[model samples]
Target: MNDIDAWVWWLVGAAALGIPLVVTAMPEFGMFAVGAVAAAIAASVGGGAVVQVLTFVIVSVALIAVVRPIAARHRTQRPQLATGVDALKGRQAVVLERVDGSGGRIKLAGEVWSARSLDTGHAYEVGQEVDVVEIEGATAIVM
Candidate 1:
């Protein structure tokens, strides 16, 4: 086919690759799409078919090699901030009522939470301090 037609086809391929990048949230597809755009530019400037193909491959591979690892590192380096009840674990609380093995109440994170002692034989009096061990349903296990 003519160079103009070939460049058009390359641009079409680039657009096709972009669809999957958007749908799947994959960065590799975006890299390939950019490579396809580069190849399209090469074809427009009178590059031979072999040169166009090589340009596409080199650009795609280089981007994948360089960008993918940086992206992965960024993904993994994000600080994992605990939320919800998971954040309550390991926090200090004050007993609002006598807490025994069965149940009681505690002031945790400014909220009153149903609490039980982590140790079956131990008990906490009102105004005692405790550490939350875990959250079980609507209750907190403390010690």
Candidate 2:
């Protein structure tokens, strides 16, 4: 009980820091845990208490400074992958029936969908290619 080394204590501290990282899903704890491991390495190499403490502080602060901004940027960035109805917008469709402000049909994204013109008094003839301006609940508004 009296013979526990300083390096062993540092490793235990690292494990303690890791517990919160896993439970809270916060990355800062992981950075601190890495720092504690660095301190443990210093202690294993016969460094004094001051050297071990400095190793922990420097490593932890460096990791936080380098990684935090990158993580924040990724969190704030919008995903680029368009999906579902959003993907259908700005796509080309073939008019299967005469399309006007009233209504018609078009083959959009390999499926036949009810459609209408985006502009009134403008019409698309059958077999004409039109752009899908927007989708409105089972209907494609075309232009």
Candidate with maximal lDDT: 2
lDDT of 1 by residue, 6-116 (tens): 789999999999999999999999999999999999999999999899999999999999999999998988468989998899999999999999999999999999999
Quote each prediction's TM-score.
Answer: 0.78, 0.77
After superposing candidate 2 on the true structure, give the runs of residues whose Cα lies further than 4 Å from its correct spot: 76-86, 100-103, 116-123
Looking at candidate 2, the ten consecutive residues that score lowest on lDDT are 1-10
Model 1: runs farther than 4 Å from truth?
Answer: 1-3, 73-81
lDDT of each: 0.96, 0.97
lDDT (Cα, tens digit) per residue for candidate 2, span 28-104: 99999999999999999999999999999999999999999999999999779999999999999999999999999
**Candidate 2 at 114: error in angstroms?**
2.7
Worst 10 residues of 1 by lDDT: 1-10
Instruction: Pull out the clashing pairs in model 1.
Output: none
